[model samples]
Target chain A: MLGLNNRDTRFFLIVIALTLFTPFLLQPFPEGSAMAQFNAGYPDLMQRFAIYGIFAIGFNILLGLTGYLSFGHAAFLGVGSYSAVWMFKLLSLNVIPGIILAVIVSGIFALIIGYISLRRSGIYFSILTLAFAQMSFNLAYSVLTPITNGETGLQIRLNDPRILDGEGASQYTNLFGLDMSSSFKLAMGDYVFTFNAGYYFCAIIAIAAFYLSLRIFRSPFGLMLRAVKSNQHRMNYTGLNTRPYTLAAFVISGMYAGLAGGLLAAMDPLAGAERMQWTASGEVVLMTILGGTGTLMGPILGAGFIKYFENIFSKINDNILHAWFSALPDGLEGFLVTIIHPFVGKGWHLTLGLVFMLVVIFLPGGLVEGGQRIKTMFSRKKNSDAASDVKPAE
Target chain B: MDAILLQTLNGLDKGAAYALIALGLTLIFGTLGVVNFAHGALFMIGSFCAVTLQRLLSISYTTIDPEKTDFLGNPAKIETPYIEGWFGPEIGAAIIDWSVPLAIIFAIPIMVTLGFIMERGLIKHFYNRPHADQILVTFGLAIVLQEIIKYYFGANPIPTPAPTAFKGSLDIGVMIGFDPNAIIYPIWRLIYFVFSLIVIGGIFAFLRFTTFGMVVRAGMADRETVGLLGINIDKRFTIMFGIAAAVAGLAGVMYTPINSPNYEFGMEFLVLSFVVVVVGGMGSLPGAVMAGFLLGILGSFASMNEVKQIFPGIDQIIIYLVAIIILLVRPRGLMGRKGVMEE
Candidate 1:
């Protein structure tokens, strides 16, 4: 079972299968069709799905388990990205060293920030993290120009000293001579499935991270973290030091964010201070909350759902809307398009904000809880049906 | 000495805005026991009210002038604002020029109505919920409000200028027994500082003197007791919410001339104001005001060239850094009451 219970192992397998066949599953619509615009099987988006999947899973550990809502988690992600780009600058274009350094550096950042921020719980903790992140972001955009390249972001240069690579190497990020962007496109008539090196690399890491989260969810350490969330006073009375546990969760989640950032640079070797913005941190929070906090799969699902919606919603223009509703009567079609216009196009954030409010109000447990409720409803119906068949056996 | 005086003035100006927003936040928090993440949005809306009025006044109609030739040698189109046509051009021009100040009249009613609706419709239900739930719901609401503004305003900072008279710099240092032109400050910033003091003072006076204010203060201290006295405290809290919204709206109204109003400006101030509120001690009005000015001054001082030379980027982060240090030392903040979110 690979250290998982029966249900967990099954869930894990299903997730792995889904990730493996994502290129197929995501591109359900064939080419040269209107629905193909919604297809998210492309390399760039698939990489994001995996990368943000890692980010949300890590966030869930701290917020869902320890109940310490760190509003500056993006700072760690930014640090990881900066470190990764630095690795690409000084070292070789190999992703392994870059990703390793990213994790280590972000871990250090998390330790320092976590140690300071974890002193106060609740809203105080959230503000402290926010303040720290804003500081980093401002510094990165201004004072740290020597290191961060200011607003332009960090990128590769041909004249740079990459010590590991001999004479001439591909300037692009690579994994043992395999370029990150190198992808095999399998064309089956109307459908095309892309298999990118970066996506697979991220997918594998995301899977491992997801598995580790599952183990943590079931472990005694996770139990302690949950206890910290439930009642810290009781934990203190029980003579349990919740600080170390919370800190560990914070650092672990920080590392997850770091890994996600490193993977982002590995896919496309660039880093920007914008990654450290409070809004970016808020987005990850929205993902974790909108999925289902404390669930192994919920955070990942939330991340993917948001990314997908962001991609699809932002792409819809008046033309597309008109095309979709062209069959409707003229007035009705015009009315529908006008009503939906504000929620689509560049107004995707408004839709997202509204969704977050609705989810917080109606479905606090997120989509997972909704799924569970539907399941129960079906089971209750079956039970009622069975209860009405009493004369059949007689 | 001049440098110090100038920095102090700059700091006080910055603090004035912070204090106003923080005051509103504390008022709502103290009265309703709700952590309003949407308060910043209300401030942004208030700023936009200035922009809205400015745009409204400049609603123009074009006419082809027979005498004026176009660049293409045709008759030129002379665009005249509707206000210019209805009122005299001079009066209409003055009205447009003083849009920022004029926005106060427009913003007060709008912000108060929005506040009343917010309390009655959304926040009333969240009173007994966990603080986290309150935070999330408000955060969502803030996003929605901000996005709506962005949709209309196009994410750019609209430059709403101060009146023509106040646009010039004032050499106040000489009047205060300093060298001539030793410390020159903008008139609008000075006005903003004085305006904030007036608002702050008026609020304090109202809360201290008025019968309603006394009842509300009592309700803040002990809601159940006020309720037992048969004095419908919830309606009073809603009214307080409206007043707080008006205070924030007025702050935003005056602030447009100093800093061009943008959709994201609210978010920018939101964190800083929250810091001020926390540093002032949650639910403490005077504390919120005090912390706002103190941090604003400290932040200004941090941005000084001498300070920046030694601790580069200190200007950007000094307020937050000070907040962290204070929180660690005094977990309850500078003037925070005991047992008010002490945990």
Candidate 2:
């Protein structure tokens, strides 16, 4: 089906289905309910889910398959955002040109950085990429102010030289006549679902990117990357140009980050220097690792989990906690709240840090490994149960 | 000449900070083969030691003062420190004034203990893991430590003042036959430079002269070989980790007055320090110090008005620019021994 093998075809179908139904799936609670705050179906966040999903998929191609952990991916992301914003400033509010420019610019940047950084491998490689990213960040926040708009970041002004913003056309991003922010509000009983033009747009692109990544993962080039990771010495002895392969992966991933950045700007017309910061890069890495580095579904899962936590979960406050445990005895609830206070709400960072540590230490392969472990355990239990039942009275 | 000298002096203080942090980083890396992303947090904690002592000493009781009023039109509730109440105002005030210096004595043990706990509790398990995994775990630890500090002390930069005695700048240029104030440098900065020198010299001497240091050096060179000789290299490495932590702590303690100790200061310094480490070479101790000073000096020079005229914000990226150039030209770094981490 669709030129993919049976398994891949199934995977594609699953992803398509998920992306199509995301609005309904994400909006679990009814509007006006207390749990409405937890709904991630809003345009802004849903757009992020798709955008970051694309980003992670690209990242996995390099880090997961090639085993070249680029710590400066956020640099590419920032570059993409800057380029997209510039495109908006000069050309039009149309996202196509902006996104294309983002990919091309970031791809060039990745090519240059990757060529230099890939000279060394392991920790040295990580450091080199980090240095490059830091330099870029410093430049964006300070030196490149004319272009990047300094620490305040670049934002669209009312009088931008957008050549395509004809006489009475809208200043906002659009696809032909369809507004990016335009959404359909479906009212069914108590639940209200938002079908946003922007979210769907991003979702389609993310799915396409995901499909491309899947193809790349299954391609012969991917096998060579795995080979490079598993045994570089033998690969060298056998005489293969590992550099080009790694560099290609790096550029591809950088372009993915760029696309993600462009989509972000498409959703909200702004670009900040902080987007280039190492922390942003680290977040992407964490997303990839947390989801399951090498797997297709893992990166998307990880990105969603993190974005959800950062956006929705972090907003849970003392009031929410109190409400949650209100059914318990007053004294017990108060004690529980106090005990749990330090790891939630504003203390979400502590939880994030601790969770990161736990994931890295315990589940090195990430959440997917945990899932696999559970599945195997259940299967083993069932098998044992079958054996026992088949046996006589024992 | 004086302007150059002033810049050099400016560089020295920053150089001292970079050197101290990088030195500890090298020590830990050399001894344990683990890249500690949380080392800067140790330095931050060291600075916080000064803050902690300041808070501890300034534990106060409110008393109504009829002589003065606060912001509102009421009798000022003057708070007298416990130290002032216990020991007369003069000595207590002196103690409070010298809190940063006093923090050195307070921070060392705490830092060492923290180091020990960090190693035994967390990093010890990661010895055999891939470098990426190690970096991730340490990065996580850094975040946890940062958030914890932020939780206790808000995100603002807390200015931990130096002693009043060392507040003024020394007219070293006039003493060297230049105009007065032409080459004036902060006294505390000079002290910090001298302190760094002493610390660096002391560490070198300890490694050269002492038996434990010798054994540790031997272990760093070849741990299995030292273990084969039944030296218990693990214990020595743990002690080395403690020493490294104390070194970073001392640096942080001294740096509080220079740069107000903020929760994010660790992260801010970490990138530069890590760059210093890389530019110095992965496991080479002297290289770290050399790179730190070299980068620091270059950075100061780049920040000059003349340089900024040529290329704005050059100073901000000078260290990174130098690092990239160096990494490209010499992958092993200035004094990095070949094949340590060349692959």
Candidate 3:
């Protein structure tokens, strides 16, 4: 059971099964079907699902467990990416060294930022993190142009001194000659499934990240983090220093974000300063909150839900809307299209904003809490049915 | 000396804007004890009011004129704005030219009503929630507002120019014993600075002199005691929210000519204004005003070639750097009262 309790073992196994079979599960629709547009089994999108899942999972460790909402996580992610791209340029096209360097560089970056930002709690802490992130972003865009490549971003060139990668070797990212872009397409009857090496690589790392997070969650350290969130003042009164604990949590989460960033560069060997923008940081926060912060499966679920919606909803346009509602009466169809127009296509952000607001207002615990409520409702109904049967016997 | 004076003037105009926005933010925070993320959206909507009025005035109808012929030999058509028809053409043209100033009248009621609804429908419910939740909800609202504006305005910065009279620059170097043309400043920028001063002055006098302001200040100090005095403090706080919204709206209205109002302008200013509020002390009015001008002047000075040569890119992050240093050194900010948001 990998040191997990019975229920946790089952939950972990289920998650593993889901991630392993994602290529099959996501492609519910067959090839050439109208609904195929909604299928998200492609390599690029699937990799994003796993990568951002890791990002949100890491973010939840700090914000969910310790209740320190750092608004500067994207800076660490950006640093990781830049380090990864640099490794590709200098050392090798192989992803191992690049990813390792990414995690290390981002960890140090997070440590410096976290140390300074954690000085104040609550809104002040949020603002401090925001300030640091904005500063890093500005520096990356201007002063640190030599390192970050400025606005054009850092990319691998043809004639770089990649010492570890032999002369005339493939410039693409790879693992021991296996290209990340290489895929095996299985066409069975009307359905086609793609098994991508890059996706599998990202998937394996995501699973490992999840398992590590699970261990951290069950550990006494996690319990201490929860205590910090619940009552840091009381923890201070108990003569115990909580700074190290929160700082550790922050650094670990920063490492997780770095790992995600590394995987992103591995999948596509390019890094941009836009990755460090505050909006990117806000996206991860949105994913964590939407999925159910502090829950084991919540961040992953939230990441998938958001990525899926972002892809599918943005693909919808007026033409598609008209086609979907063609059977309805003209006036009614026009009304529906007009009403729904603003929530799709380039207007996806509006829908996201509305959903986020509603989630914060009503479903504070997010989708997981909603699921729990439904389960309890059904169980209550079953109990009532049994009581009615007993009354009839009496 | 002229260079210094010119930069100071430039800083004063920028500071005026920052002070106005921060003052409203501080007022709401002090009175309601709620951290509003959507305050920037209110500022944005105010700028749009000017755009909206300009658009409304420019609506035109075409009339066929038999007296003139088109290039195609068809009847010539003349397009005339409804305002031009209602008033004389000269007067209507003047009105359209002065739309930015006129937007002040148009934006006040609209911004105040929007603020009232935001407080009653959304913010009122979040009063007892955690600060994190309040931040999230308000942030969401800000996004929604921005998107709505983008949907209408098509994501372009609309130009709302000042009146023709104030379009030119004024040279003050001659009068101040400097060489001719040594210091030339925009007339509208000067107007904006004076206007902000009046607004800031009015807010202070209101707080210092009025009974309503007294109760609100007392409520900020101790809400429970004020409520215990059988006063409907909630009503007054809501009114305070309206006034704050009006102040922010007026700032946005006047700022239209300075930086052609765009949907994203509110968010751009929001971050800087938050820094200003924090540096000024979260709930202090004078502190907000002082910090606004001080940071604005410092910002301009940092961008100077001599300073940039010594330390490059200082102007880009001077405010944030100052905020971080001050927050660490003076945790309560410049003039922050004790025990407010300490937890």
Candidate 4:
């Protein structure tokens, strides 16, 4: 059972199954159909879902467990990416070496930042982390141009000294000899499903990351972290130095973020300073909150939900809206289109903002809690019904 | 000396803006004990108020006149502003030219109403929630407000120029016994600095002299004690929120000519203003203003060529660097009162 309880084992298995069958599950609509435009079974989109899922999962470890909301995680992500691309340029196009270096570099980076930032707690901690990230971003964009390649971003070039791969050994990133972008397409009846190598690779790593997080969440350290979140002052009063524990959690989460960033570079072989921006940090926070911050499966669900909306909902234009509403009366159709227009296509962020607001206002625990509430409500109704039946019989 | 003075002068207008926004942020934090992320959006909306008024004033009717023939020998078409038709042509043109200043009047009521609604409708429910929740909800509101503006304004910065009188630069070096043209500053920038000073002075005088301001200050010091004294401090807090919104909005209204109002300007300023608020201490008004100007002036100094030669890219991160150092060293900020957001 992988050191998990029965319920947790089942949950782990469910996640594995979902990750494995995402291609088929996401491609429910038949090929060439209007609904097929919403199908998110392609290689590019699937890879993003898994990668961002890893990112959100990593973010949740620090924020959810220790309640230390660091708004600078993207700095680690950007550092990891830059390290990875450097590996690709200097070492080889192979992903393993690049990814390993990425994790190490970002781990060290996180250790330094976390050491400084964890000195303060609460909103001050948040501000400190934000400042560090902003400084990193500013430096990367200006002074650190030699390493980061400045505004144009760091990318692989043809004539660079790729020591391991020699000269001109396939510019694309690979795992050994297998190209990451290669995919196997299957068609049956009117349905088409793509089995992408990059997605599966990301999925495997995401699963491992999730398992590691699960272990961390159930360990004695996790209990200590929760204690820290609930009452750090009390922990200090008990003569327990909570700084090391929080710092450890911060570093671990940073490594997870680095691993995600490495995978991203492995898929694309490029790094940009924009990845370190505050808004990028905010996106991960959004995913964590929208999914149910402290829950196990919430971040992944939130990541997928958001990525889906960003890709599919934003593709629906006025032409598609007109086609869909063609059967309705002219005035009513026009009214509905006008009403729905702002929430879709280019205005997807508007919908995202509104949904995030509503979630914070009403569903603070997010989608996972909403599901739990519904389940409890149904069970309670059943219990009451059983009680009424016994009374009637009596 | 002249170079230093020029940089200081250059920093003044920007410092004025930062002070105004941070002042409002401090006011809301002190009165309501809520971390409002949407305060920057109020500032943005204020700038847009000027843009909106300018657009409204330029609404025109077209007429064809046979007296002036076109190149193709057809009657020429003339477009005239509705204001010009209502009043004389000269008066209407002047009104259109002075739209940016006139927007102060237009933006005040709108910003105040928006602030009241934000407090009573949304923020009122979150009074007892955690700071994280307040930050998240307000951040969401900020995004929503900016996105709504983007939808209307099409994501471009609209140019709202100042009146013709203040369009030129002023050479103050001659009057100050320096060489001619040693210090030439923009007239509008100087005007902005004076206006911000007046606004800051007015806020201080109101807080020092007025009964409402005194009661609000007492509530900020001890809310439970004020409530126990049979005073409706919540109503006064709501009014304070409106006033804070107006302060931010007026700053935005005046700032239109300097940077041109854009949807993303809210977010850009929000991050800097948050840093300013933190460096000033969370709930201290004078601290906010002083820190705002200090950081602003420091930023300009860092951007100077001499400083950049010593440390490249320092200007971009000077405020954040200072904030980090201060937060680590002092923790309470420059003028922070005890027991206010210490946790």
lDDT (0-100) at residue A18 of candidate 2? Answer: 97
lDDT for each candidate structure: 0.91, 0.90, 0.90, 0.91
* Candidate 4 lDDT, A184-274, residue by residue in tens: 9999999999999899999999999999999888899999999999999999999999999999999988988898889999999889999
lDDT of 3 at A35: 81
**Residue A203 lDDT in candidate 3:** 93
User: Over all chains combined, what TM-score does candidate 3 have?
Assistant: 0.97
CA-RMSD of model 2: 3.4
Question: Could you tell me every candidate's TM-score relative to the true structure?
Answer: 0.97, 0.97, 0.97, 0.98
How far off is residue A68 in model 4, in Å? 1.1
| Candidate 4: Cα lDDT at B214 | 95
Write candidate 1's Cα lDDT for B199-247 as tens digits: 9999999899999999999999999999999999999999999999888
Residue runs of model 1 more than 4 Å from their true location after superposition? A384-394
Clashing pairs in 1: none
Higher-DockQ candidate among 1 and 2?
Answer: 2
lDDT of 2: 0.90
Q: Which lDDT tens digits does candidate 3 get at residues A228-343?
A: 99999999999999999999999999999999999899999999999998878888888988888888788998899899999988999999899889999999999999999999
Worst-scoring 10-residue span by lDDT in model 2 chain A: A385-394
**TM-score of the second chain in each model?**
0.98, 0.96, 0.97, 0.98
- List residue ranges in candidate 4 displaced over 4 A: A384-394, B69-74
Docking class of 3: high
RMSD to native, candidate 3: 3.4
